[model samples]
Target: MDFGQIINLSLGYIFSPVTIAYALAAVGLAVHFGYAGLLNFGMAGFMAIGAYGYAISILSFGLPWWVGILIGCVGAMIFAFILGIPTLRLRADYLAIVTIAAAEIVRLLFTTQVFDEYTNSADGLGGYHAGFRGANPFPPGTYGFGPFTYSADQLWVRVFGLVLLGIAVYLVWALMRSPWGRVLKGIREDEDAVRSLGKNIFAYKMQALMIGGVFGALGGVVFALPSAVVPAVYQTSLTFFIWTILLLGGAATVFGPVVGAVIFWVLMAFLDAFLPALAAVGVLPITSIQAATLRFILVGVALMLIVIFRPQGIFGNKRELTFVK
Candidate 1:
């Protein structure tokens, strides 16, 4: 086992563009489940819509990349409104069921052969990044050191992803500090109490949903930036991964999701490299094939331990734990 390689690999994931995308999604989720008392199990749907909307707009309509992004954001907001209107008034479980089903429906719709002309019917879209890459400022060469190195295009994606993530974090932080944020927190703590004050709980919840859903959409666009927008990438498992990042970082903290995303990917990368190295050395009883799956098993155990010993998460305040089920 090369310890240096493992360390470098882990560090690489800590700053990965994909990790930044997940962090953005988890931050949006932190607003939904952590601060607004909403259970949105269909985050993947927002992502899928964002990615597909952006891709289709650029590919089918010949729209500029920025215009496609705006369209994607608007599309996600509309989806949020549609999802939240009927379900936000109901119990959280109802929202959860609707959201999860809605996400699956969206995924299936993209995969359906009827939309082959638009969506390519699960084959997904590519060759649409030319305009996006045209904006890259980096020269055509490799950057970074050792395992952390990246080509010019890859470096542009990382820089762009980090910039977007920083903007998202700042936006969420500013929102949470405003009067609107106070209402969200109040609703999260006690909806009846907030309603008693004559506040429109449903409106607030819907607003939060839209805000978070937009964030998820932006994340989806970022996730698809380096490659095509594949429907399979927006499965329930993606939402679950975002949830894990949220929990791992501290659900209620502003920076928790960002930290959680970095940690989650870094640890996963480390385990992926380390377990295979161990298998090769015969230090572990498992074969390389089993090691691939076993890394997740180890990660699951670690998550279980985190939940048991520090349910509030690494950076979460104890008071925030009250909001969680």
Candidate 2:
């Protein structure tokens, strides 16, 4: 079954850019749902704005890679403001509905032909890597050992992703320890009480939305670093996957999203490798394709189990966080 090969492939995801991307997005979700009790279901839209903003700026406007990233962040914050202005004062469920609809709208807009000159419509955007690659300090050589080994380009992306993740983690950790964070938690627990205490609940929610949306946008930038910016990649399923990661780890905890992303991707990588191998060896009666599909079913079951048995997640305090509230 080539067990050794499977192990190496699965373990390599520990430092994968994809994992870092998801981790970054999940952390943003944590800010929305975990600490602030905001039901934001349009994170995919934020990511798309980030990826396309960065790519389009570089390709069409001749901007620097760093400026493209800044544009992406600003784009996401603008999106958050647009979404939050009318909805943040409404029920949480309303925010969810608006977000999901808004996300789909964003995707369709990118898929439409009107913006083809910039977005390229459904064909997506690429070839914006030159500036980013030019900034890579690593020489042309392989680095690391075992499952962690990678060429200079690969190493550069991973290192950059890790640095961004670290900064995000620190920012979230620091914010959660301050007065503003306490107000956010209070709003999450009981908005009416916070309002009674003279807090501007709407403003807090807007700020949180913008901050988290920026994080999600950064995640999109990372997701596109090693690949092209395809509109199809920002579907609703991506938001659900980030939610799963957030729930799997302690949603409210600073490091929970990071831990959750690592575990979820590692398990996915393992299943992706092992399931096909098992089917090939006749260990599983299903075909290789079916075997691959089963992994998602298993993940769905795992998510249900986590929600039912431990809604607070691995690092979440039961009293501080729960899906039932």
Candidate 3:
């Protein structure tokens, strides 16, 4: 393997659009599990709804791309509320079970033969993003230094993604500092105490879930921008990756999830490059295929170590954690 190829490949993730999307999704998750104490195992579902909603709207309705995106956001909020309201009052495990099942249900629905006319099922949606890419401002040229570079479209996407990321971080920072955020923290600490203080605990929880789901949905839309709306992309594995990033960066902190997302993907890319080299050169005995599989195994072990040593995450306050169990 070429050393330059490995370095450049590893560095390519630094400004990856997918990284930004995951960062946004993790930020939303920071609100759900981090501060709101809600267990949303179906974040990927919200994302799928957002992705398909936007694509389908633009494809079928001839709406402006921005309007379609707004439609997607609204759809995600409504979907999250629909999923959250009826389910929030139940036990914590119920939310976990329901959300996870709900996610799969949504994925299947998208891929279901009945909706293929609208959703395109397994083939997914495309040609709708022409309007989106038509707005790119970058002139045709390779940009960036060394391992970090982007084409005109890619650069535009990252710029747009970073803007969204900034807005999300700022919004969460404001929310986490307000009285509403404090009540969320209170609920996380003890819903009973918050209820004793005359607050509507369920209402707050619903709002938290809805808002966080909005973020996830927006992420889904943005995440698919660089790619396509493949229904299979919205799986439990995506949610797991988001959670790992959330936990890694230190949940409950305003910037933790975003930071964690960048770090996690970057590290994963790095390992994907370097580990195979080590194995191939006899630094280790594993083959490239095994090396690839082992990357996730190592990441899982690292996450386990983080949880074992600091359940609150790198930035989370131990006192703010909600142990519903």
- Model 1 spans > 4 angstroms off: 323-325
Local accuracy of candidate 1 as per-residue lDDT tens digits, 192-307? 99999999998999999999999898899889899998888889989988888888888888999999999999999988988988998999898988887898788778878877
Clashing pairs in 1: none
Instruction: Assess candidate 3 and give its TM-score to the true structure.
Output: 0.95
Per-candidate TM-score against the hidden true structure: 0.96, 0.99, 0.95
Q: lDDT by residue for model 3 over 1-325, one digit each (tens)? A: 6888887787788678788889889999999998898888899998898889889988988888888778888888888888877899988799999999999999999999899889998999888878888888888899986776778888888898889889999999999899999999889888898899899998999899988988887898888788789988899999999999998887789888887887898899989988888889888898987988889999999988877887777777776666523
Order the candidates by lDDT, highest first.
2, 1, 3
Error of 2 at 294 (Å): 0.9
RMSD of each: 1.4, 0.8, 1.6
Please give the clash total of every predicted structure, in order: 0, 0, 0
Candidate 2 C-alpha lDDT tens digits along 1-325? 8899899998999999999999999999999999999998999999999999999999999999999999999999999999998899878788899999999999999999999999999999999999999999999999999999999999999999999999999999999899999999999999889999999999999999999999999999999999999999999999999999999998899999999999999999999999988999999999999999999999999999999999988998878774576
Model 2: number of backbone collisions: 0
Question: Lowest summed lDDT over 10 consecutive residues: which window, candidate 1?
Answer: 316-325
Clashing pairs in 2: none
